[model samples]
Target chain A: MSERLAVLKTYKLFIGGTFPRSESGRVYQVTDAKGGWLANAPLASRKDARDAVVAARKAFGGWSGATAYLRGQVLYRVAEMLEGRRGQFTAEVAAGSGLSKAKAAAEVDAAIDRWVWYAGWSDKVAQVAGGANPVAGPYFNLSTPEPTGVVAVLAPRESAFLGLVSVLAPAIVTGNTVVLVASESAPLPALSLAEVLATSDVPGGVVNVLSGRAAELGAPLAAHRDVNAIDLSGADAELARELEVAAADNLKRVLRPRPGTSWTADPGPERMLALLETKTVWHPTGSLGASGSAY
Target chain B: MPSSPPQSASAASPLADVTASDAALRRFLHGLPGVDAVGLEARAAALGTRSIKTTAKAYAIDLAISMIDLTTLEGADTPGKVRALSAKGVTPDPTDRGTPPVAALCVYPDMVAEARAAVAGSGVKVASVATAFPAGRAALPVRLADTRDAVAAGADEIDMVIDRGAFLAGRYLEVYEQIRAVRDVCGTARLKVIFETGELSTYDNIRRVSWLAMLAGADFVKTSTGKVAVNATPANTLLLMEAVRDFRRETGRQVGVKPAGGIRTSKDAVKYLVMVNETLGADWLSARWFRFGASSLLNDLLMQRQKLRTGNYSGPDYVTVD
Candidate 1:
């Protein structure tokens, strides 16, 4: 056979379901865990973070208003797509975290399972978090969990594949659109996942993956007036504190990860509830008569 | 501050004699210097890139907010919609009362009374789109009646669409006569002539039409009707501004330039403002001489103003739905 040339992959940001280069026209050198030159990832600037927030906010309306059953089905389809590309992710996971092939495959396996776990919770979260309250008056008092609009998520620093899925699935399965800053040192796997998300039933802008510095991307998002909440799981101590202070201006719900948090641990409904708002509705009921007892 | 355009100077201006006949009007309009499309567009693009930051940006935001002609011209418009738009024009941001009121509240002729009442004592003027706007296909008598009815209903300004069919057919005299009639019916209400540049097809035609409107006694030469496939673009706006600038220099009668429609973001508004500052100097910066016939542009300026005030980026949730 004659000598053949190879076509290299171009790493671009997945925003609003399309791969666009950084608006600043800046790209940074990304290296494998061994500190060897790997590829160039788009160095998303403050403007890109601004654009991601806009996209997330635009998608929030349609995604949150969709039926819970539909969201669950869409998220489950993401897992199915991820499974189809498990080999590719395993290689990326190995390069990203310097893990053995077996360990990387295991991480990819757990990530797919994490998606399945979160998908199953989409329709059931409201029941677990909401209930009808007992009131003395003839009124029905009900509390339901609602998505807190656009959320800015900082993916975990390590465990790039599994950790990314663990944080992302919870926010989206609960109907909150996300602008997620991928792992700064190992953003390739997360960027690859964007392809999976696009092909699956996951809607555009539902999960925007920006590969850049967490500090650069997170600051604007936390203080952004339009963002309803922020999850600072991957932020460092200094960065997290700064973001929390900025988030206070808009009264944004903040979800900062506690120390010693493990991505492999059985993630309870805590992450999902953090990105949700409790809306308690009160409806007046007429006195019991021909209609029987009031609800 | 620049003085207003002389109302009775249609006969007194240097170019007044040209509008006396179709042949003369065509000679003057066509004889005018041709536009360099590439150069004009490059200048506009260059001006668009100037970074107006810090205090300068804050001032521009407030200035843009005040210059907006808060318009809602949908076929499904109601009295309630006009009142809400009036409130928004009067005080664009409810959270911050320090925000400046917009220049005008623009609506259909039928909604003028409602808009006038809603913005009654506020400095915000009530502008009505008349003269069979957007198409201008009706007969001259009907179009004039539309203007008279709008003015009678207390419209502070009249936005009329020029007959593109007549203008394109080289019937400048007919188009000029129609505008003069509408201008007479407008009376005290300032008349803004809409060329709908997207349909004008060429820059030279836009320049000629601008001069035609100015000579026919237009208080403002507007860019578009906000209903076309293409509306106020930067290149077309720059061409219009150049026309108004040249007209003022020759006739000593300053005409207002309003780039209406499709200008939705604060960034785009600032670029137009930059063009105005560069092309017409600071004299046309205020609402008296320059205006943006826009609906959503107000909210974006407010969001940017809020962002600058608080040192953080803002979202759509903070701004009202309108």
Candidate 2:
């Protein structure tokens, strides 16, 4: 008897916490290293990108307003789910990048660990960034860091699993909602990661993953006036330049890509800090007990 | 048991003569037409894609501002809260004095007097939500009294909710008579009937309810009470707009439409305006014909308006809390 046929999965874009085919009904065939057909990734249109930004914007209020401790717990839960699905990630990473099974497994483990690293940073980011300031006047001065609302990210194609986690973990850990364009060629792993995120208690629209050409999806997102910031760590020089210019329409906070930047290196707090805005508040400090300087 | 009563002799009420009997009303409604849900939703979504940008966007923002029925229907509402909402309504963007006052201030019956006093000389009409507001679970006598109290309290406009239980239970005549009775008690006040379409559960029912309200002498047919889980959606609003357009075509008299609840953005408000523009034409684009039943939506519009004028994005703190 012939061996049972493997049922191939159809990958859809994750937008607004639901899996929907592109409104344009366009999809591109994705293949493995040996050119074996893997899945059909949705060729998301400009409208799809705008829709994702809308979703991310809608989710910003709730996700950003959530208690820091709750966000930390939810991010940690993502790591737990990713660890449970380690073997699946390993297979996809291997099939997507033509890596050895052992190497792919290591990448998956590292990706899961990256989530854990950022999960712990969620609550600490506020304390590390916010503090009282000494002013000469009779006023209490303090500055607090706030999330810069909705962000659009172009995920690196080279390190689909690790690099995707590297960019996504920090943006969301700091309370900003994200609309990310997945690696154009090796999008299967990113699509699979969306499933993990959906089950990991990550709010829908909090992190939307679109699998398509980077420029097509990224252009609209960059130009979207509602999008507050953008990360171009994955784009090539030409596309990155174009996106950065388009992002200027709304004066979006941009993180430009540089050559030879390693995704495997330890990501610093800069990734989290880059997406936050400092808001300084001043309140008049009255004389303590009717006596000037009671102490 | 359907009652076949004698037809009244006046043309003042077109529905009064046609719907003389319960069976006649049922036949008239069910035979009005079947609603194509997909077609309605697709049309609404398509209209929403209109890019009212730059110069056109500025005009739409102001137009939307003037067309808003700045509303507060909270159970926890107080006199002070209503007064604040009224002040915000009269001058939405206090910093930008060029900003126009909203079309009206909508509140509950009890707060109608306070809202009226708050917006006294601003030319901002006071609208009161009556007939037990979000729910029409009260008796006919009580509901009529509720409408009378608001009208007596100087409410220029009365927003009354239809009894969904009666309409859903095939009590067409009862629903029609109730609206007529409320209209009678409203005296000179314009009657805006709330269908609470979410509870009705189907586009066909929304269409029927809209016509039922209009035929029974409603000055405007409102979408929701701003209290239902699902209120004033684009698809439902579009369906109601189409009904008013068709109603005018069939009967020479024109009616207005107000969609309340869940519309909390300048963009959503503009989309509804686009729907009104295309579906009902420019005639319904004014405050006289169309209005948004929203509170937070006004501030967002103000913020967007400020952005357009100043060329910088503004935050919530820049706008008033109301």
Candidate 3:
């Protein structure tokens, strides 16, 4: 009997909700731990990185302005989509990382839970991170947390699924749009995740995913004046320091990778809080009289 | 059909002695050559990447500031608002008196008098949008009356929108005649013909309308009415610049260009300047030739100017809201 042929999927970069081949029309090969050939990932160039930043910046206003409840709903929807695509993610993760089926399934499960975890923090981030201040003057001063515009994230290479989700979900949950560079070698899972995101209620450009070498794509984003922040969770120490310096051009909030960090650990609010900015507003406390005079 | 009948070497006005027949006019416009959308867009995008930094950037920012026609065109516009806009136009950067005032203050025809009075003593020109403005859907007489009101009310410049419906319906003569009539009413004030290019739909149409407007005696062929879904994009403005450039080489008359909408940031304003500088050379880099029709854009330019001078970014609180 003739064997049925398997149809392989072509991986494309996700920018502005569309799956487009790299602007440079270049692709790099992805392989498993045993060097088994996978799909050719888009080798995104500086131009692609710039396009992604522009998209993220464009999506920043709508996403950041959305009510915390709506953002939470969108994030939870992303989790739901990821959950539905669990089998696809598990297979892709195993193939990409050469992990055992059980281990890959566990990683995929953790990633889904990570999204759900960050989804809950979407609404409560402001409450936990901001409060009213008691000033000595006759004034009502309240500080609220606001997203720091567009973020450029370098997803971890080793634990592709869990690490990518861990970095992405936190930044986007609190309303910031992100341009993420997926795992260089094990990028199939991230590319698959893009499909999940596109199907979810998450807006286009809110979380742009690029599959390429981290340094190649991360440099332009790090130096882009329009980018408000960056996550270097995947960069080596040397690359991290270089990116941190480049990010200073616009003073982007840099989240350096913690050495020997465990992707499976329950990440505290630090990642979400790191991407946020506190805006303290002061309003005059007028007297309770019809004259509206200050106390 | 090589060119538009080899325009008169020394025509007194832009439309002094051109084709008088509809066939000739259509042939003249249609014969001006079609624009290759891809090439034109690529050229505009390429020009947009020229990085003007440090001293050159500082100079460009200030030059862009002086070339602004700070405008407020809303149905809800009040005399008080016009006065405030006029004041801002006359002194764009209040904290630093050294900053140059914008070239003009653009308003509606009815507010021209108040706008004129507000900037009476200053050299800031009062530009009024006339000829039914955002949409030039009125009769010729009514449109001509609108132009006359603005011109009589002391408008140094009159920005009039072309009848897109007429132009799109292939009624070239009606659109040309309307612009010519508006030009006659404008008299001394410069006539800025708005193509409302967004409705024109294609780059080819934008190029043709540009030449048609210039050939109809437009002192400046402007893009958009600042009221369309897409207004005054870099590619559209670049095409208009190309038209002005070619028109001058053909007719020996230099026309100005104005890109009037959705251009808000200092970066965006500078990119347009780059397009103007490279496309038209240094000759069209002055306030007399190139103008930005925006009000909020001035504040952003001022903030950038402050950033350049003070070595730190300035917030909106540092500049006036208007």
Across the candidates, what are chain A's individual TM-scores?
Answer: 0.96, 0.95, 0.96
Q: In model 3, what is the error at residue B135, expressed in angstroms?
A: 4.1
Expressed as tens digits, the lDDT of each residue in B141-242 for candidate 1 is 999999999999999999999999999999999999999999999999999999999998898899899989999999999999999989999999998898
**lDDT score of model 1?**
0.91
Model 3: per-residue Cα lDDT over B216-274, one tens digit each: 88999899888978998899998899889888887788999999999999899999999
lDDT of 2 by residue, A1-295 (tens): 9999988788999999999999899999888889998889999998788778778888999999998899999999999988889999999999988999999999999888888999999888878999999999878899989999998999988998999999999999989999999999899888888898899898999999998999888877776777889999879999999989988876899999978888888988999999999999998877765567743
DockQ of each: 0.79, 0.10, 0.07
Name the DockQ score for candidate 2: 0.10
Residue A192 in model 3: shift from native, Å? 1.6
Report residue A77 deviation for candidate 1 (angstroms).
2.4
Judged by DockQ cut-offs, is candidate 1 incorrect, acceptable, medium or high?
Answer: medium
Which pairs of residues clash in candidate 3, taking residues 3 or more apart in a chain or in different chains? none
The prediction achieving the highest TM-score against the true structure is 1
Q: Is the docking of candidate 2 incorrect, acceptable, medium or high quality?
A: incorrect
lDDT of 1 by residue, A112-205 (tens): 9989999999999999999999999878999999999999999999889999998899999989999999999999999999999999978899
